[model samples]
Target: MKNILRLALRAIGVWATALSLFSAGGLHAQSFPSQPVRIIVAQAAGGLVDILARGYATELNRLWDQPVIVENRPGANTIIGAEAAARSAPDGHTLLLSNSATISINQFLYKKLPYDPERDFALLYNIASSAYIIVVNPSLPVNSLREFIELAKRKPGEIAYGSFGLGSSSHLETEYLSARTGIRMTHIPYKGVADVLPALARGDVQMALAGIQPAIPLLKAGKIRVLALTASVRDPLAPDVPTAAESGYPGLNLAGWFGFVAPAATPRPILDKISGDLAQISNRRDFKEKTIMRGGLVPLLQPPEQFAEYVREERARYSLLIKNLNLNLD
Candidate 1:
């Protein structure tokens, strides 16, 4: 009888604790972000991701009537900041403004990550995406994609390409192109975009896959020729530049995307609210124009559920591509 009573008391205690936790969670969800919110950007300031985060912070602060501060914690290919965000409380007060590197590609490129991309965070919304431009020196005598391919075939190992770094999106995409087209272009690695631009201009490298922002001014000044852009459709900013799909290379569809996320256990209502607000902001005419001017495309705003699904698809797609290409940081 004593043992029976003791077990019965323990069961009652467990039920009461569960009830209290549920009630507190409900109350916390009801009044989320009672304090200023912090957004962690996994890159250094002045980069594309940092620019987007600051812009969004301005709007988010106005909408929520609370301060939203963005903190840059760069290094380790964004794993440092990502792990910090993942370990934050699930009250929606701490958020992450992550890019393709942190959320999707890093999983396949790195041998081990401190945080699990899929398990540690809930997707809120995808803010924007941008494409890369395949640019070569104007003196190369290749103006069109077909012409470029023909020239590449003729030169083979002589046609070299430069990227920001090994295992970077540009590097992987170039490798993908080489594999698809059966052309072996020499791979030239650079420290960053700063080095890439000068190298291309000096003819130190024959060609490169660069973000549209860096290539736009150079292309317009007649310094380089744009063979094709890596987007599903032609960029309005550079409508004359054909997409890779139209250039007989439909497999070369890669774009850099940015999005927001909170800890996975965050309440659904909070995530929905953030998603809805971002959807409104992304469609504003002024916001659209600014995004275009910055060489980015305002993404088609997706609700929380749709955004989650989109990330999952991206994760799977990149995972397969990375494995097949044998891409790794080390």
Candidate 2:
């Protein structure tokens, strides 16, 4: 009789525990994002990442009926914002809006990072990607990528390239090209992209790696000529320009991407919900058009697992490149 009573009590306890877990999960699924969501942008306002984050926030607000705020925490090559996001509560209320620089490149550029790129955060979704166009002053005689390469080879170190900053995506892309093609060109670092075009126009720097959106008007105005794009395919905005892959350098394909992430311990249901909403937003025609108009590529939406894998690949690629080049900012 005692043995039977003990077994019965154990069975009751198991059922009660199961019931409590299910009830808690249901409550969590139902009440998530009960307040405003905050997205920390790792750059200053008015930058490309900021623009995309604000646009997405507007759409999310419309969908969630709650304010979705974008907070700028720019500095330390995005480490500041990334660290903030990594430390936030994993309750779906806080997120990060970041670029390849923060998620991939910074880990290698900085000697020591405050957070682990892989272990500290959960990747929610990739928002959009944009390719860089190799722009040169029209005064330069080079028309094609091959011709540009020949020119650089002839004058190795004479043709200077301007990048936004040291260890920035622009700088790394240029370095990657130099490593693969054996083309040597002097690197000129600027305070920001705003300085790159001016330096190029004044002939202070003859060549640059810049995104197509900012380069388009200048190209149209005959201020700059595009030698090649960093994407595998030519940009629709500039159909005439060939990609680096088409120009006999298949390894030069690189692009800048934007994405969202939350702290790693966020619940699976919350992640799924956020990913679903983001995928829907990415597919909206207006969103696509606006992003393209602003010089961003349409986003390739992926679930959390797939996005995490992509981030891992990028992190590894940049890590190797940075280590090989001995690139360090701090």
Candidate 3:
């Protein structure tokens, strides 16, 4: 009878402790956003990612009636911003605006990362996704993808392609295509897509994988031709261009994405609240027009856990592709 009484007391103490913690979390959620919320952007100012982050911050501020700031931390492949975010308190006041390369591919590309993508952050929502385009110089003598592949086979290393940088997504796309087709071409790395397009126009390079905005002006000037796109479905802007699936290489249809992440230990209530608020805002027409359409991105918001699984899948996919490319940025 004495032992039974002691066991009951211990159980009551455990239950009381759990209830107190639950109550504290409830209080935290009620008083959430007691101060300014910082959305750290892991890219340079004036870029598409920055624009999107600011747009989202504006909408979030409208919802909470609180100051939402976008802090840009641009260098060292997003490690600087990511580390800052990782070290922040998990009180739901801080978030990271992350991109595809930083979240997915950086793990394998670098020998050491300041913060582990999966371990340090919890996925909040995927903001947008943009498909890559396969553009070739007008002088390439190939109007279609198959024809271009045949020419690359005929010329071997004589055919060269340009990319923004050595380990950029476009470079990986070009390298993977070369791997799948069993073709060899010299890689011409450029400072950015701005440089790559000009090089393509002058016949300095044969082909490149670029997002729509960078390639549009050249396509209009007749400087380059877009033989194919990477969208699973046809892009509304360039419906005439065939998709990579139509071109018989679905793997080439990789879309770059940007999304929100918070420190991993953030309370579930705060995560759900922010996610729900953001999803409603993302579905609005004006936000879509101003941000998504202008930047050639499709608004793609999903639940946090679902987005987390998607990130894991993307990481695994990029792992193989990066390995094939032999990219060693470290």
Candidate 4:
């Protein structure tokens, strides 16, 4: 009995000593900015992701009273940038601006990813959510989403739609819609949204699911008509445009979300501080009006635990959808 007690006492002593050896997640939260903060943007400069990254960096620089820089690593559909951010030190100084493609959809599109989004990083916040507008050529007699669907049914496979690429949300969203609605539309893939928008205008494709910001120019110029949004609710920016749910298909929520993430081991205290700061930025009325609202998006600032749960749900949802669509791009 004494020998067993002695062994147990020895193990306890070692554990106590190890506990005192170093700090874990929360100890350094108070003085965290030990250096400048770097935000790794996974998209090219001038895009919405880059624009939001710069905007947040600017605001965070002011809040931290330290320089915050953004480094763009746009390519390979966000794999390069995501891997860089995942490989970064978990000191809360390096943050990756992520989108649905990186956090959720990539697992379905590719056979394997270099970094595991759930294991390699901690989701900080879901900045905002935006949905694609289902736009059709004005020449068609489809002013409403219902009319458009009915027309597609009448002329199955005759209504052609364009997307950024084969594995893109634009393409997959339409595929899912077609499957659910029992209609067929020809798929025309383009290099990017810039390339596809003109195709949509020229009627090379009869329709497209496009972003609000890009669709604004064509919408104003009378080049295309937005029938409905992929979001569950109508957009406040364009109140006239109804959502898919409002238009009769309640299961058609294909909204794209954006967020920031740090390496998985990043301290919770530091993550909370950053999340608080981002919430502050997101709450600014003028900021919302100028940035988020202008692009037809609403701020969706969620806590770390909530955001993590959201990511998991999104991943599962997309995984099933991708498998059902049989979309294996890579």
lDDT of each: 0.78, 0.81, 0.81, 0.82
Candidate 4 segments exceeding 4 Å error: 1-28, 137-141, 154-160, 164-166, 188-206, 245-250
Please identify model 3 stretches exceeding 4 Å from their true place.
136-143, 146-168, 185-207, 214-225, 245-251
Give the Å error, residue 141, model 2: 4.1
Please give the TM-score that candidate 2 achieves against the real structure: 0.83
TM-score of each: 0.79, 0.83, 0.82, 0.82
Per-residue lDDT over 72-163 for candidate 1, one digit per residue giving the tens place of the 0 to 100 score: 87766678889999999888889998777778778888777788988898888877776788889877988887788889999889987887
Give the per-residue lDDT digits (tens) of candidate 3, residues 1-330.
999999999999999998988778778888888899999976656556777888888888988889999998766667778889989999899999887766887788888878888788888888788888889888778888888888998889998898756565667777888888878999987645566778888999988877776567789999999988888887877879998779876666667888888998998778777787778888788887777777778777767877888888888989988876678988
Error of 2 at 238 (Å): 1.1
Q: Is candidate 1 or candidate 4 better by TM-score?
A: 4
What ranking of all candidate models by lDDT puts the best one first?
A: 4, 3, 2, 1
CA error at residue 28 for candidate 4, angstroms: 4.5
- Which lDDT value does model 3 have at 29? 82
Model 3 worst lDDT window (10 residues): 164-173
Q: Count backbone overlaps in model 3.
A: 0
176: Cα error in model 4, Å: 1.1
